[model samples]
Target chain A: MNIGILLKEGPYNHQASDTAYKFAEAAIKKGHTIDAVFFYNDGVNNSTGNMEPPQDDRHIGNRWVGLCQKNNVKMMVCIAAAKRRGINDDVLIDCGEITGLGNLTDIAIRNDRLVTFGD
Target chain B: MEEFDDDEIVKKIMHVMRNAPHGTIYTYEGLEMILIMAAYDQDISVAFVDDGVYALKKGQDTAGIEVKGFAKTFLALDGYDVEKLYVDQVSLEERGLTEDDLVVDVEVISSAEIGKMMTEQDVVIQH
Candidate 1:
């Protein structure tokens, strides 16, 4: 099955992002293909490649990027949402980058299932 | 991959358009996400009721506070194949608004019609 996961928050303040990753990993183990992972609202912060974690903390951003890279999943952050949250490739924040909703729409149009986890 | 019947699979997306005096970034964001999801499945319908009607309202001024341009993006739903846009009649009446107040071309229906539409989907996401 092709599944699209929507993560609407980052890890530091919400659990939705973490929950989405866990589900993604499990789904892949079950042989499901993660067509895309789209971020909206505050969730767009997950795409900042410049996230900073303390020495004692987990690299949450890296984890999400790694998961998508490992699984060949398309990580999409809503352009409008990302800009509002001040997250984009040119802005210099951390895990992900700016992407158009067109990217998200493409994934949605092709995926068999669309599941969103938000707070 | 396991084969499944398309008829057996249903997709339902409920959009929450909060037009509160303070405005809600999350609500609009949620709708955008649902729109992306609906664009993928032909069966997906986006229903906006209550405060959700504000989502399609034009002339938003959420500047200086860092809110995104949602109304503009919302106008692109039809190109994505998301043809079903619903607005509740009661919601509009309560707010003293009419179809002219909205930014998009929506099908204004009663709450009952919205309920019936929900029954057709396999999953429902209410933002």
Candidate 2:
């Protein structure tokens, strides 16, 4: 199965980003191909390289970068939403690429499933 | 950016508005997404439920709230070829509103009906 994920909430403040990561990891383990993870709303915050959690805590942004790198999945943040929240290329993680909503529509069309994780 | 191909499959995408227009940016950003998606020539529909019903109510003046009012933007959706707009009947009555209270035309339907429609959609994005 080729699945696309739409994540719409920020990390730490909401459990949405965490659950989305777990779901993607489990899906990959089950032999499914993750087509892409498109972040909108505060979900773009998950692409920030500036985040520094406690050594004992999970680093949400790094987790996404690592997962996408290991599995060869595309990580996209909506350009319009990103700009509204001050997320630009300078602060974006390596795995995250700023894109447009048309890509989201394309993701919906090409993927077998388009799942949303948000408030 | 990749150009949208006319040969690509047209998706049935529904944007579900579940929040009030103000006090948060969800509804506003959701609208921005819809406007962009509409240009792709996909089949798009919008459902206003919960406090989202208030977004379509007539005479929204944001001057006092200090936020730019986007209520009129809903009216311009038709120009983008996005004409399928649904309003929750129960939500309207609960808020002491009717179809007449809305600034734009929308089909007033029951939540169950909307649920059935949602199942038919390829992508249902809720805000």
What would the DockQ be for model 2? 0.76
Per-residue lDDT tens digits of candidate 1, residues A1-119?
99988776676898898889889999999999988888877777777767788979877778777886688877777788767676657743333556777666555545776787874
Give the candidate number with the greatest lDDT.
Answer: 2
Query: Model 1 — TM-score against the truth?
Result: 0.66
Q: lDDT of each prediction vs. the true structure?
A: 0.71, 0.93
Could you tell me how far off, in angstroms, the CA of residue B64 lies in candidate 1 after the best superposition? 12
The segments of candidate 1 whose C-alpha lies over 4 angstroms from its true place after superposition are A90-97, B1-22, B27-45, B54-83, B89-112, B119-127
Query: What DockQ values do the models have?
Result: 0.23, 0.76
Residue B42 alpha-carbon offset, candidate 1, angstroms:
6.0
Report how far off residue B16 is in candidate 1 (Å): 4.6
Worst ten in a row by lDDT for model 2 chain B: B1-10
For model 2, residues B1-127, the per-residue Cα lDDT tens digits are 1235766577788999999999988899999989999998888999999999999989988999899999999999999999999999999999999999999999999999999999998889999
Give each model a TM-score.
Answer: 0.66, 0.96
